[model samples]
Target: MMLHPELLRAARTARRPLGLATVLLAAITLTHLAQAVLLAVVLSRIAHGDTAALAPLLLAVLAVVLIRAALGRAQRLTAVTAGATVRIRLRDTLLARLGGLGPTAITGARAGAVRATLVDGVEGVDAYVSRYLPQALITAAVPPLLLVAVALIEPYAALALGLALVLALFGPRWWDRLLARRGKEHWDSYEALAADYLEALQGMATLRAAGAVGRVRERLEKRSAALHRATVAKLRVSLVDTGLTDLAVQGGTAAAVLVACSSAATGRTAATGTYLLLMLASECFRPIRDLSREWHAGYLGVSAADGIAALRTAEPAVADRGTVDARWDTAPEIRFLNVHFTHPGADRPALDGVTFTAPAGRTTAIVGPSGAGKSTLLSLLLRQRDPYRGRVTVAGTATAAYSLASLRRGIAVVSQETYLFHATIAENLRIARPAATDGQLRAAARSA
Candidate 1:
């Protein structure tokens, strides 16, 4: 299966652990082969009626079994660890990118859908990183090792197992492609359903008041149906893929078994060789079988990956980093010279050819009935946006010339709406001055 570039990029963050896990998987495969060999020898000894040597071989088998189990457990745990780490890093990057874009940029789209994608969508990628990815690496490494093991015991069986692997791994190229396509379609429908449902739920009251609830419900039902169909289609692909893998495994194993049994019956092979052939042949396809099953999990992850990648590539809003201090920090004069600006999707410039000056150390009031660009002037001075024509100057220097932080530090606004941090009272006030003391906080409160 093709992994999304974003997922591959994220894997680098947990590369060390995933690599260790993959290597561990190879070790587990070796241990499994060892266990099979030990058991085969013990069985051969019993077949020859050599019960006296059974005790030592039995103990050896037990030790190998225990070690294999432990390695399997460690491999699983490491895969989980690698998955979690990569997921956290990717989610954090997405968050930082979204934050950098600021409210103005995000406000252009559906907030509900964005929220769903940020949370549930990101959460969905863990299966790929933790399960499918490591297994894929293990599959590549394990099969060859298994092939060698079987060849040493019986060459014909190795041939059969190798042929089976070829069919299992590469025979379903078209099916895998279809699976990925179906997976993407499913996720798209699911995300749209979530976004629409959340938005509709939030505005249910308004819809009810306007007597449009029925229409909204109808649209939501249609979206739900689409999602159902998408899921069914994806599931169909998964079932067919699994069936094919099972068929290959059984057919391959049976052929290997027949060759081994015939050689033994004809005295060309020993009992131990026949036993090893059966055991190792079955084990050979185990990893490939696992890869087939994990394919669905990986495909689910691909769905969320697209949204995460989009957020990551969204051009970071122009850096707001303040490099130089504002020209004036206190009671600075504001001048807008032949300035022009237009809001998004607007028919005409809101402040075309606007010219105005507010003198320092004096209060100036902008009065307009409605939509007269009253707030626009304050926004320009705040450096929230830049003028399209001419310049907005503070204390005789263009506002853009100063760093965003330094320029904003020189201005303050009292808005009708208040935005507060989710923190303790003391911590919230600390935003105004990070080093403010308890006494300063009390005094500032009283003064306010």
Candidate 2:
């Protein structure tokens, strides 16, 4: 599956530290390979009564063991560092994009879906960075080195090992397309379930008041069932892919062993050489198997990346002007000049060529029955939505011309349904003017 170019680049860039880790891991792999070859040499020497090679060969095995442990630790550290960097950058980019888009774009978005993306989706990338990427490199690198080593001892075994690797890597690629399609469906179902459950909980009070809680619960259950089904289907596909990869590895090992044994029988290769080639051939497929397993885990990350990329690509609201002077203390006049607006999917305009003015230092209350576009007018004045036909002006300048921060600085709104924070009364009012003196607060309270 093709990754988004930006995400792929980010993943690649994160691995700069892993360059050294890669070299270290390769050294470890080679050390293990050397140990295997040495074991074969030691066995051959023992048969010839050469007691001198035994002690040094035993010491070499101990050194290889230590190096292998050190290499594992180094690779893990580097992989974690890389994964963390990628996650931070991905999250920052997602948040910046979401912020630029503002609340309107997210108005209809599900809380649970957003939570899943911000939490689970971002976290899921860890496996891809830590396990999948390094393993893929090791799988690609180690197998060839082992093939060369095996070729030196037993060329026939090497040729057989090469074919097995081809089967292991390309065989999964064929299934990857299918797995990716299923994975997308699985993630969609999971997100849908999350959204449904979140919506149910959010409206639980209303549902209970209307005696519809059972119905909502039933709906949630249905979504849960659907999610379960999708998950199981994806799991089944993964099992099939895993089974195929294992089959290839086992079959390849068997073929290599048989070829080596026949070469030894014909005196084309020594028995010790045959054993060495067989051992290295088996080791060669170890990284390949890890890579195949990583491929399965990567499906989740790939799916998440798709969701994140889509969110990042959404067009933001008109670009924000840089911060402007907060001159709203001057109480600038508000005017709407032949403004028009139509809500999406509405047959008629919500505000048709509407024009009004509120003079400075005057209290001009808007009174209209519900659905008379009063709130729409307020929203327009607040620059929550731009007009379709005309413009709103504050102090003779177009509202859009000023930064959003500047436009809202002048207004103090109190709705009939007051939203009180879970704080002291003074704290609630302090939101209006954070640094107001005690006397000023008392005067404002008296005015209220």
**Runs in model 1 lying further than 4 Å from the true structure:** 317-322, 326-331, 361-363, 367-385, 405-448
Q: List the pairs of residues colliding in candidate 2.
A: none
TM-score of each prediction: 0.87, 0.87
Candidate 2 error regions (>4 Å):
1-6, 12-15, 18-24, 46-52, 321-326, 405-448
Q: Any idea what lDDT model 1 has?
A: 0.81
For model 1, how does the per-residue alpha-carbon lDDT over 1-448 read when each residue is reduced to its tens digit? 4567887888889989989888888788778778888888888889999889899989998898899999989998998898889879888988888866755566565776677667776666777777788788878877788899788877888888888888887777658678778878887888788888888887888998999999988999999999999999988987887777788889999999898998899887888888878888878888888887777666766777877788788864345754667745478888999999887779988899989899999988889877889887887777666777879888988887788767776676667766677888889777867999999999877876
TM-score of 1: 0.87
The residue-level lDDT of candidate 1 at 40 comes to 85
Query: How many steric overlaps does candidate 1 have?
Result: 0
Candidate 2 structure quality by residue, lDDT tens digits, 1-448: 2344645655875768656656666777777787888887887788668878699888988888888898888877887787788888878888888866766556666778876776677777766765676667777777887788888888778888888888877776777777778888888887888888887887888899999998888888898888899889888988887787888899999999899879978989876787787778779888877677776666667767777777778775455563555476577888999999987668988899998899988988878888889988887776777889898988888878878766666777778779889998888888877997888888988987
- What lDDT does candidate 2 reach at residue 17? 64
